[model samples]
Target: MDTSGFLEWLKASLSSSEKTSDRRILRFVHPDDDKRFLRSLRAERPGSKPLRGIRRLGIIRAYSCPVPPEGLPVSFGGAIVWEEDIRVSTHAILAAQRVPADSGIPWGVRRIRAPEAWSRTTGHRVRVGVIDTGVDFDHPDLRHSLERGINLLQRTALPHDDNGHGTHIAGTIAAANRMQGMIGVAPRSAIYPIKAFDYNGTAYVSDIILGIDWCVRNRMDVVNMSFGMSTRSKSLLNAVSNAYRSGVLIVASSGNDGKRGRIDYPAKYPQTVAVGAINRKGEIASFTNRSDSVDIYAPGERVDSCWLRGNRKTMSGTSMATSHVTGAVALLLAHKPGLTPEQVKTVLKRSKRPLRNAKAPRKTGELDIARMLQVADKLM
Candidate 1:
């Protein structure tokens, strides 16, 4: 409900001119209110017109109007709240980290104990929705696990990765067949690419909400969001809440700001599993964000996975760590498809491997996917 960020930005932009000419964007309480408010604003302030808008769990509407210079338009009375729509990529430096062990599998794969997990379910029945830029549906390592997708930016059915970030995240979650020298934690899980970010890896909160809405409508088992923003958004929280209520497990990156302060939105929201990064040494990554909201740590430093153009590359970030946990969730869900979001969290917390040097209990250790599967089997 914090509309302060949006209001502050509007005030600064309006200060440049006595009467601003640009459209002011806002999230309304309802669709009917958005229509009625825009009609009233135009009637009272002439020349004001409604611009682009989208309605999901919340109503997002924008309008072009002349500022009064004295105060905000009366039409904005209760329809106004802080719009925390601006979100940035949580990816850290993109360089390869050398692995000491010569295990044929990627170090991250080994770090999460994924090979042992393969003996059980390989995540065959789970569907993970990657709400990032998009995925490379043709990449050899990911193509087999890739399923249908929707592009929110272009309003299309195919959501392809142009930024390469989404492909990396997707590959980490469900790469299959050891193709192109890579294997994901949940190799057999289906990945549904929900393209919310653009080529620059930038996404708005509204776009993310739309993507989550799509996932809920499609009944996706889990959603992986490897991005973060500093602000708390109402619409984003509403979308996440609705998704969780609908039985979808959500995972997100704590952030890569390297700060000990609060983590990012949606992840900070209690319903999400906020993940931080650990390096090859099993120590917290130097760039990983720390906070109570972070639920677990995973291998993220210099991790290699599928990339654009059927190639592979090493990247580091809580984004990569988030993908590992997403795959782990798929593995658990494949065995126990009826588990609720709270049940999934409990299993993950119960099966976590303790880290000797972890700063706190929250970042105590990495995910033990094999152990998680064993626990799931016992529960069944």
Candidate 2:
């Protein structure tokens, strides 16, 4: 049987006495065939039912199962791949990577030339889904654009923010550019916060996958992932593929591990745009992970944006950088709702401004939101 079928069987028969060492998630080539697959699994293996079903995405129905001492079968009767579930952490390194900000409008805002782009579109018709902890809807800057959110942590439909990280990310992407405080890249865009992480800023692979599934089912135009994990998960690949194939542009943080290692998984995945961090001087931050998968760089060091309690805070991480691209993409999509993930990527990559970064060669360039908008306008 395939890994999905095997896992479905394993989840049903699991007991304290079973000493299985496998930790695998399985996916079917045709996600729409889930019902048929499940029925076949039941017929082939008696007394088995999956613990639960994740069906909203229409690309995967993952099940967790143990690995027998011997090993996973080379192949199931049907097509399937065994995948591992890896924990994904908020990419923020806290104050450790924070750099001193020079006196001026937030460098990130000025660097991308967001004010000029605003004249064209504030992402009015675009819908963005943030897959993070949650957003603080009470924050004045974020209150209007933030719609109802799903708290995957508690499995509730509540607008909540436990770790404050998600709120910060949301503010970067859609905080209404009110005169009083910090503004976002796409101020008028709609934000859907999917709380996948908990108070500790840690989430299981399952949580992130479910969040992506939700985004796909809801028809999100853009999905922002400000987190990273080193290991790759087949389940995640399937989810991302589903979203991309369905016309959602997924953006993720390249990671904060610096020269120590490669870009983190999900970001490293081809379907998502991997963004790195840049300092105020338009140079890559030493902490931003340098890897071939990094598709672009954005202002992330000491970047000022909205925080919890209707406050503004300065944070530094590839996570913050990712929201810049997320909002930028939103603006593009708002101007042209039919922009495919590939077309949006081409415009952003082609319109990037040249930058001098000795340490990170993958830092394609800094975001030029205005130019991107102009190109998108012409294309549309």
Candidate 3:
């Protein structure tokens, strides 16, 4: 939108108070008003004038909405979504690769590739929702970074990490351990655990939709979905679509069935970035499912991290890989303020760690951290 026209629209909205009588148009606003946009809510009714600073910028060509911006995707094709600001929190992206182990509950911090950039920034205040098996609040790797959570599956008052999958996924993306263990992709990031699966690895589509709806309503910068299914659900896709329109990033596992191109529900739905499994050796795990929807690969086979029952163990599947990408997306959100879910996907794909061969059996490449932070805005 033109600068003059945008200003004019804001002035008119403040006076009339409506974007349109029937719709809430969500798109990017200028830097000066982004913060205010988040803190302030539009009071105008559907048919009122419009909200101030809200512009009909049309489709943001800079970022791919995964699915197109008009309405929702045909088969979860795409949705119109936009992000407000960058949440740069340097404390959130630290890792634990080389840290020394503790005697009993010790965990080391894995150093991120670009410490210099983070050194100059405190990191963004990015809040990512972890929709998985639930997380343990006491895990050494995830203690301080833990924030709020919900249990959509059990409908409990508090959502705890029971299945261990959510905790590992949480640790990978936002665990903030300054003295020990590993730091996540966005170490300083806050985690909102929304448990949708039980310890038995079962969940209902209704619960998953609730989880996605919560993330969207709560304004989560990214949602870590470590589960997938073969059958498609209207509720699931609609929830995802609602989230996209609300500017929530959906990252899901590519499924662990290990079958060649076994179709997964939400992951296969074009609305999400489906992550595949990769071993420490950078090889795709044999059990990892392959599909045209697989967006990227990450450490999955026996990938070591926090586990269920307060245990630290190795687990496999695209579930682990999704956490890696989730963490990475959190980092980008922290530094690249104002990135749409689509733009974040764009940068990550561009920065991907190339596979050994483009024509190899596993075309998807490994996680690329260095290239991701190359264009981040300094938080400090």
Best by lDDT: 2
Give per-residue CA lDDT, model 3, range 1-380, as digits (tens): 23334334444544643323222223333543433333333333234443432332212211111111233323312222433211111001112233233322211112224343456332358888987777888788778777777876456467886556677777767656657565565677788898777776666555566677778767889898887766665546656766777788899887766778664768887778878776655667677787767777777765556755555655566777787778777767776767877777677666667765445454456666666676343221
Q: Write the per-residue lDDT of candidate 1 for residues 169-259, one digit (tens) a residue.
A: 9988888855335788888899999998998899766778778888988989999999988877766777788889999989999888898
Note the residue pairs that clash in candidate 1. Answer: 2-82, 3-81, 3-82
> What value does the lDDT take at residue 245 in candidate 1?
90
Q: How many pairs of residues collide in model 2?
A: 2
| C-alpha lDDT of residue 325 in model 3 | 79
Clashes of each: 3, 2, 38
- In model 2, the runs with Cα more than 4 Å from the true position are 1-23, 28-58, 65-81, 95-105, 358-363, 378-380
TM-score of 2: 0.84
Candidate 3, residue 349: CA error in Å? Answer: 1.6
The predicted structure with the larger TM-score, 2 or 3, is: 2
Query: Residue 354 in candidate 1 has what lDDT?
Result: 83
